[model samples]
Target: MVLDIIFLMLISSTSHVSANSTTVLPAAAAACSNGECQLRDECSTDRDCAAGLYCLSCPLEFRGSRCVRSTISDPFKLLNNSLPFNKYAFLTTHNSFAIRGEPSHTGVPRFTPANQEDTVTQQLNHGVRALMLDTYEFKDGIWLCHSFKGKCHDFTAFEPAMDTLKEIKAFMSANPSEILTLILEDHVEAPYELSRLFRSSGLDKYWFPVSKMPRDGQDWPLVKDMVANNQRLIVFTSDRSKQETERIAYQWNFMVETQCECFLFSCCFHLWIGL
Candidate 1:
């Protein structure tokens, strides 16, 4: 009876060992097939992976064989240390009033706010890269704010606008890998006041333009000074005359030659360049 009990015990122990070995073998093989022993956790591509391993996707700001994080400190670092001057342009499609003719107008037209928003959305959807908004418009023989033009709209004060501008600047600072190029088009405004407003708003870092032709007496010295101070600002002349066009071409060519950035007239009818 004692000999029979010993034989039964030996059989039970052998069976247990066999079951454990069967369970462990597949797991060990899987680990080996995944290259976990050799590559550890670092992998770039599927080719770098073993039979059971696969590639994983990385963040948008990152680019590498292994989908590793990027080393770039800032996301919005401008390419070539300058904005693409003439690569894009835009023309405002919606007027303050409903009336729409050409982009340039002598008086404010009646336009619904909802319609303007819808138009902006459509332009954005149709690969419109930029938008130009007439911040101030000449109406009733007086200059009126386009944002609040024909309606009793509750608008943010200048201080709040400045604060919002700071927040935007902070966001850009945080996301340096992202691109945020805004061109402020000052339509028939005093350069000094516009520059002051931008500076107060903490948006002086962006490229801004003051229209030159309509305000004839103004000098380019302010623009030059702004540019010299590492502020991206340019002078824009309307396409009024053949001589003017030639002058623009010459000035544009000089800017290009000197590696200075400037915007040009765009072919797209509805799009306008803006900040």
Candidate 2:
């Protein structure tokens, strides 16, 4: 096995080190035979390294100090460090008003409020940045319904979609550093109505225009950059017809998701094996 020697370059806390400068550690505290380790390197344990940077023992995969950064990474940490939004393995969730309660790849959501404990505001307070909402035209008003079985059932959960949008708008205003993604299980007959709701809800200002989007699976803009430009919100609907108009993005175009067929097959295969 090849040992990749790690080098540590440390300058005095009160002084700067130039290319020609050299400082030596006392012989008693040095652990590295090659004389490269400073305060933190070639460690017997992780306490030698600075806070948050665990020591990486070369080659072997082990617990604690024996860890290596070559293959290990937390995408969420990367995201916080200003990787593009599309690079986030983590997402924002929103718990605004809705009956859809999120769904599977098959677009199926529970109509009975199963597992629907938090309202949209509560979800937002708890760091949820994604919202799964259902949109419908009901009773002469645009409402969010827990539509199941091919129709919006009156007995299921329901609320005005605008009310929820208001909550999201307020949250965004209060938390300027945060970002959100809206996933709509769109069932409204008029594709343009989605635009009207967004506009009226005061969310149109935060809309990310299609023209700025990267094409062909290209990288998305950085989250900080998006926030700085006030394009901190992402909206996606299942309705394809509504896309590229009034800034309501289509989910199929934006999300690289597993097809419904493949997802179902994988689930069924797992179930069969479990049995």
lDDT of each: 0.29, 0.55
Q: What are the candidates' C-alpha RMSDs? A: 26.3, 16.4
Cα deviation of 215, candidate 1, in Å: 20
TM-score of each model, in listed order: 0.28, 0.59
Top model by TM-score, which number?
Answer: 2
The true-versus-predicted C-alpha distance at residue 70 of model 2, in Å, is 32
Model 2 per-residue lDDT tens digits across residues 161-219: 78889999999999877777777888888657878888999988888776676656466
Tens-place lDDT digits, model 1, residues 1-275: 00000000001011111111111111211222233433233455555455434443333212332322211122112233243333222222322121122132333343422223223333333222222233332332212234443332223111122333454456545533222322232343333443354467665554343332112222222322333444342322222231232222112211211112222311112212112
Q: Pick the candidate with the highest lDDT.
A: 2
